[model samples]
Target: MLNLVLFGPPGAGKGTQSQKLIDKYQLVHISTGDLFRAHIKNQTDLGKQVSQLIADGELVPDSITIAMLEEEVDRNKTAKGFIFDGFPRTVPQAEELDRFLESKGAKVNGVIALDVNQEELTRRIAERHKLNGRPDDDAEKLKKRIGEYFDKTIHVLPYYEAQGKLAKVNGIGEIEIIFNSLCEVIDSF
Candidate 1:
């Protein structure tokens, strides 16, 4: 199994590249943000809790996020692999993911971190907010999310780096160019 963690801050183009990776590699794309949005849209019990935390610009508790991720993975037992996007944001989360994957005799093959500067991310997200109008895309929430990534989530990079499983891709170019760069990393694996 060729599992991957697509790591990046909000507005770093993780979602766009994830789609291309899925197409080329036939990977199940498990984006926590997408899962949260789906639940919120469905108005499930978990959605109610996630919605409020998201509205307040807070990270969802690790336990809830991990459980949701495990359920998604379980549902796709025969998947060729999985692209984990917007997940394992903290060191603890990464450790938990490693343990979970180990139980199934699989492991994360690689972790790709999209390297985009804050200014660029802000600009891109501003444009995206105008188009998508996702509540979390509002300026205030975006700031918080970005701060959260830099302050806490970025630590996850070194965890993988220590294992020699982290690769960085520049995220400030044309979509195809960036996707191609990501493919090179995955191909190397």
Candidate 2:
């Protein structure tokens, strides 16, 4: 299986690129944020807990997140591969993912990070706010989210890098252009 981790800050086009990659690779897109939203919308027990935490601008606990992810992996028994979009925000979570995947006789193929500057991300957030009315794009929330990425989440990159499975694609300019670059890296992987 060609399991992948699509890494990026918010508004760095992770969602956009993930769609393209899924179409091209026929991979299951396992986006934790999406899963949370779906669960919350459906009012599942897990979703209720996640929604409360998210409403407080807090992260879901790693144990809960990993259990949800494990269920997802188990559900997709015949998947070509999986593109993990937003889980494993910490090194420990990454370690957990590794162990979980190993149990399934699969492993991460690579991590593809969309590298974008803060200025560009700010600009994109503005556009997204206007286009989608995303309340989480407020300045304070953006700062916290971006700060979290740099302070904590970005550290996950090196864990993958040490494994020689991390690749970066410039996250500026046209969507297709960025996607083409990502395709190059993924194909090589």
lDDT of 1: 0.95
Considering summed lDDT, which 10 consecutive residues are worst modelled in model 2? 50-59
| Cα TM-score per model | 0.99, 0.95
Clashes of 2: 0
* Tens digit per residue, CA lDDT, model 2, 66-125: 999999999999999999988789999999999999998989999999999999999999
Identify the runs in model 1 with alpha carbons over 4 angstroms from their true place. none
Taking all chains together, the TM-score of candidate 2 against the true structure is 0.95
| Deviating ranges (above 4 Å) for candidate 2 | none
Can you give the lDDT of residue 177 in candidate 1? 96
Number of the top candidate by TM-score? 1
| Residue-by-residue lDDT tens digits, candidate 1, 118-147 | 999999999999999989999999999999
Clashing pairs in 2: none
Q: Count the backbone clashes (under 3 Å) in each candidate.
A: 0, 0
